[model samples]
Target: MGSELRQAFSVIRKAPELISPAAPTPKEFKKLSDIDDQEGLKFHVPSLFFYKNSPSPALEGKDPVKVIREALSKALVFYYPLAGRLREGDNRKLLVDCNGEGILFTEADANVKLEHFGDEIQVPCPYLDQLLYNVPGSDGTLGCPLLLIQVTRLLCGGFILGLRFIHTICDGFGFMQFLKAVEEMTNGANSPSLTPVWQREILNARDPPRITRIHHEFEPVKNSRDIFLNMNLDDMAHKSFYFGPKEIASLRHQLPFHLQNCSRFELITAWLWRCRTIALEPDPDEIVRLSFTASARGKHYNQLIPPGYYGNAFVYPALCSKADDLCRNPLEYAVELVKKAKAEINEEYVRSVADLMVIRGRPKYTSEGYFIVSDNTRTGFDEVDLGWGKPVFGGIAGALLIISFYLKYQKRDGEIGSMVPICLPLSTMEKFQEEMKKMTEAPM
Candidate 1:
């Protein structure tokens, strides 16, 4: 690293010793979800939580790094898998080693203050290299620890916790649960609000797997790449557009009687899907799909899937259409399509998808016709308060490794509307802005 940049973001300490769980966690053969076994799951998630400066006196006489390390050590007792490493099983699938190996914890000091970037804290996050250790290597995402964390104390007295997690370890939802556990330990909470459950076997495919309803198709597995990773990242821009509860209510009221009162998530996703597709302006005959995820947690999936089940329990369901048709369809039509996609994902469908994935390696997906939208609002960032104060910027915006992707982030109060963050090729951003203004500002 250059001296100048290093000065801007300097590492304080690197603790690489195994921080084993406070106690020995379960050591069993934990089979991962077939979906979790996807080749594309090789990508690691990047996350950041921004806790604002507090007027409280917790850190008045104590060291922030020392306090955080102690809390994390306590939390690790229950979350041992994090302290472990990833290993490949006989079936070529990956599972946690559950050894007492500790997670890589690095404490850093950033030269800049938190407020220097102004309103959105997610932007100007350029010191990602100093935040987390490297996870990728030869033999495909192997030989890497399951979790890595970097705690940076800002000059403004705030701290940023940057996380890098293997996708197979858990989806974004389950990761939040782990963070909450650590936060609880930090607060001296006797027990976690949600206990970790590892029943990946529950989502296993049926014997002699069968495909009941073929809604979405996947390409053969090969080397997977981010949809727009090859593009120039320097020119790409990341931004958030917000809509309020009242404005969202208006949107829900505008839909037809059958569709009226649909969820804020459904409406926002449908609207954004149309806008993005329109901005891309692809061929009329080209097939385009709006990919949305459905969580099976707390639902009766043949076997009960508890809310605290810390694993990948989400099903990938999407609405597909010809680019031409999607562009010409009414807004409500797209909303209806998204609703139907959600309806199709019952217990049988989710289980069937799992079975199908196991039978056929991970479904190979072509990026051209795919537009994925995940709801960050449900990831529950608001609940991750570490006793200092609530987080100013914490959500799924940092989850994707791709430079270009879209997700909805929960904004702080007084910030009107739902915050939708988008990262797209700079060339297309202007057109996207025009289309976005037209849709968001158009008469309801």
Candidate 2:
């Protein structure tokens, strides 16, 4: 077969400069307020991709930049035991820059006209917005330790693979335990069979970080630098909104008659929080806020941790109301206010937000203050096989400015629902796809 497809395209053109000298930053790791589970805070920024077919001929002579610098030095020494390094407080032995990391591959040469399978697995998507931008920083270059691309088929004869991650260092079961430690270092397995647990002073937070008001629901923004010292929104030009799937199943069957309890991810996040309060038409006494992401280890906040714990488990409930009480609610009262904002995940509100990030000194929450729901449909994307298979598409990358909702649920011919994939703000995606085709037509 053409000498085994020129020896697997010479082992993927020498695997990205042998994995860019196994890069690692955050000034060289250790900084979730000096680790030890003060809510274990780093290492889960992955960028995966692996579609096959195009490499044959015993993988030809081999030499794509020395097989991408030997697969980025075996993925930067296999992300040193699944990432860890944050030190400073109680002088926990000094090392704080933040988050262990390394991984970024790219090789785009397709032009569009796509659709294949004869050779199997294909989804090209013309260099998917340049392999999504990988954005996460606070020193650690934000995030992107996995991005293997190789779609060379003129327009669509074969080749497709894409994966990306960085939802604050792991969730979705600590990112599948760092993808089962990169599949035991791609099978050569000398170690990393799995067992990485940090400890972050047992998810700390209340030493001296209290605010007190607790009720009046949500208004706190007095001076967290006054919401980025006020506005700029990139001088206007990032508005997109599309709601299909039959207008997300007619707003989840009429938002359960208005929050009596309609689910479909809380009525498509309560009609995207009433379409960002009717596109900031806001005024019903303003005060709007709505955040999402509550997973401190599920099963009703699983006893806080200690079993292969990874980092930044989860939190950010937020959920306030009033822009005409979330645009005259009805989708089951905005899915019972998104199930009362996921009953605010407990464990003392994730150790009082890591003691309010050590009383607000460890700060870093700017995607424009929140509305970021990512559920990657139970994060598995075809259960990332890796033995040399299972991946036609995966997501999350450099996502900024919020309104990022990714909730996959593949399959399609045999049947499987939810797919979501929204990332709006491209100038309000054609009036959000004309109010999502007037809620997926049909009701005449």
Candidate 3:
């Protein structure tokens, strides 16, 4: 069946073109925030969203590619910076030249229906490259288009939206804000309900750049036996794990009564860290690190970040432990470590990180003994309505070597949970599965 579907699936696309703003925009240079230009965020991230055919009589014969193309131009009027190309300045800092150059856009048609993918479309999608073509010389951090979008019309009238955006420009929430603006344009709105804001200067490093806190996420670690440093990409296997109410209940059962109230993000991060460490079988005394980002917005910080401020306003807090300690400890032990790492992301911590970036030349996150997980359950990817009701599947297209995403998923029986995608060495994948099964099958 897979081979037959593969032979039947073909995406016929027109020559890609640039779609500029419908109206004139400012032609000036806008500097990005310190958090935005970090080494870790200089790459492009790809995502996919599948929309079913709308049954509304008012929208019967519309072409999604054309609709989105026109809406994208209109939306670019407010988000004009995204229409510009990135430029590098002194100290390897990034700034956008608002030249109104526009973004890369493509229109395509697929021979297969959305159902051919699966009843519940998950990550590690096989046709990701076909749906979102990576144009030559377009994936660089400098002198590259900030956003690339593709709209593919399926045989069943359903459409898939593929997106590739440079992470140095915005985070997940900021990208969603821009996408929502396009959806507003498709819905016949003259302007976005929420105005766009690009106040990157607010998160800049201080004059003296004082590093008050120790940021373990960016710490320099010299390990001769680093598992990631010696990994072969060809030997890695990607797998998706679903955790619903039952799975959560079983995992919670393994925890002590006092730690039963841990949030789902903390629980899953701790559990996965333990299982992955066991699978790798690192030295007993080797250090293993788990890193995740925490948002620095909202009233808790006295509104330091204004509403509509779409930039990278998050901090990567990391926790580390000896491999033997992490694998042998109780579930609650790792849970407490996860909680401690998350609790350290306050206003001061964020400022301190900016200082560290400037002090350390914007070093990338620690790669030795490192694992990163991102929680996208509340990112509002699934709620995007582009004249079609909502997407059947909306999130990242696949998993990276060391990074995993926690995406929101709903089962056939209407049970909502998280679908996490993980990539491990082929030799260790079986052991990883065994450890995961042990967690989810614990006695209730």
The candidate scoring highest on TM-score is 3
Comparing candidate 1 with candidate 2, which one achieves the higher TM-score? 1
TM-scores for every predicted model? 0.86, 0.33, 0.98
lDDT of 3 by residue, 1-444 (tens): 566777888999998899999999999999999989899988888999998988346556888888889999999999999999989889878899999999999899999888887753778787888999998888998888899899999999999999999989998899999999999898889999999999998899999999998777888665625766667888889888888888888888988888989999998999999999999998888888899978888887779888898899888788989989999998888999999888777898889888888998999987888898888899998888888878888998767888898899877688899999899989989999999999766889
RMSD of 3: 1.3
Backbone clashes counted, model 3: 0
Q: Highest lDDT: give the candidate number.
A: 3
Pick by TM-score: 1 or 3, better one:
3
Per-candidate Cα RMSD to the true structure, in Å, reads 4.2, 17.5, 1.3
lDDT string, candidate 2, 65-178, tens digits:
234334434534544423332334463332333344334444544443223322212122223443333333323423334333332332433344444544344455665666
- Order the numbered candidates by TM-score, best leading: 3, 1, 2
lDDT of 1 at 55: 26
Per-model C-alpha lDDT, please? 0.67, 0.47, 0.88
